[model samples]
Target: MKLSSGTIRLIIPAASLALLLAAVFYMQPRAMSYTGLNLLFNLAIPIALATIAQMLIMSINDLDLSMGTFVSFCACVAATVLQTSPLLGALIFIGAIAVYAGMGMLIHVRDLPSIVVTLGMSFVWGGLAVLLLPSPGGTAPTWARAIMTAKPPLVPMAIIASILIAAVTHYIVMRSSFGVLMRGTGGNDRSVERAGWSVIGIRAATYALAGLFAIFAGIALVGLTTSADANIALRYTLLSIAGVILGGGEFVGGKVSPIGAVIGALTLTLAGSFLSFMRISPDWQIGAQGAILIVVLALRLALNRLEKREKHQ
Candidate 1:
């Protein structure tokens, strides 16, 4: 029996992940201890969140180039507000919600291309981040830090929390009406709109979801880094996009897979870890990831063509 196109698309990345695991074990030549597991957890959590943020927007056939910059903005602002008061810090988080919501509305109303809008927003938000903290060196209040760092004594609760959140998020997206509508929008917004759904509203919701994910990502980063800095969110914009593409999500939108995005995040985190363990330089990572993504994109296109041709036959 033949597989569906979506199943075919996921195969390569799944196999690539299995191969990545093999490479790690072969290179390490050692059993993975609790410490090693913990290290992986640390790498996985933020990256997974970042990937989810990107995936949310991609699901609606929109791009959010400002995600990293927004995340940095959230972190910097949260740090500043916490210094004043926890209530203020909470307000700033809500403000991020508002900021992103407004931006989403702008995109929907202006009908500007998502990539253009988000890229410009990235610079704007990044500038705000600089203005907020200048050069970093601010501390998140101890209370905020403690809550993020707090873990169940018996287990790596941070990892557990992330997994549970990802699971529930996946379930909601897969089992809900919103999920079906969003998927329909992704596949063909025009057709979906003909069916009486508002494409703009769905798209805006996607960006809002992305913004929430960024907020959570920012908090996680604060816990991990213990300080807010400028340019913190910059790298994530590209990295998250790369992760989504690598996970078999179409760069052009109309397809979103939470599990695929998670696997993609895992692939990136493990690849970076393997490279670091081998003493490879950081500069090489971007090139390596780009090459991998290009290959995946090409394979997806080739597979898509094959499916179309077979159907025609």
Candidate 2:
């Protein structure tokens, strides 16, 4: 079967996921069952959400170093305040989203680097998270627990949730008119501004969306863990960045594939499981993850070159 370069690109992420999942299942045959699959992938929902959140930020050629700490803060709120005072907790979430939107404007107006801004905000978020959970213990709300534990007839909730996120995000980001403006803002801000669009407003709204999804990721993490800690999602920063790159997203140019990002999350989850099955130590696993990310990045660059060569053909 002859496949065009475009078709090959589309299948690469899925192919990688299938291979990773197969390797993990081969390592532990018992995990081939439905219950085992659920156990293996349930936590991926939060990671997938986080990856999408990071993708949104990257779509504007910006990196969000605060994503992990901000998610940790939200998870702390969901576990403690959300359970006790729902309205107040909801307001806090909204305020956090507003803060993210405001940051976008602040960075735009000041002509500052997003990495530096978000990196500083990371410390701010980490401080608030520590304050929220000094001792590292709080119960997830009842509804959150129920929703996280829900099991449909055939498919696992993780798969269902990831698919939903991918589909909805793909539409909003890749198809809609609003999406074009957002990408254009990143690709050529001067052109976008000349077209009569408010670049600041568009940036703020996109950052707000990123904040909202990161909140979802935090809530989902708390739901799965049934508790909260100050550093619950610290590793998510690197994982989110790795997933975006593995999923065919570029650092700039506003290029992204929502489905590819979700598949990347799934692949990362399976890779973790494979490592666990092989009894790798936590420290070593961290090193291994870094190596894997480097390899993926190299592979992506090679693929990009191939695609470019084909275009020139």
The lDDT values for all models are: 0.76, 0.88
Clashing pairs in 2: none
Please state the error at residue 119 of candidate 2 in Å: 1.2
**Poorest lDDT segment (10 consecutive residues) of candidate 2:** 1-10
lDDT of 1: 0.76
Tens digit of per-residue lDDT, candidate 2, span 27-140: 889988778889988989999999999998898889999889999999999999998999999999999999999999998899899999999999999999999999789999
- Candidate 2, residue 301: lDDT: 73
Please give the clash total of every predicted structure, in order. 1, 0
> Which runs of model 2 end up more than 4 angstroms from their true locations?
1-8, 281-283
Looking at model 1, the pairs that clash are 186-254
Model 1 Cα displacement at 235 (Å)?
A: 0.9
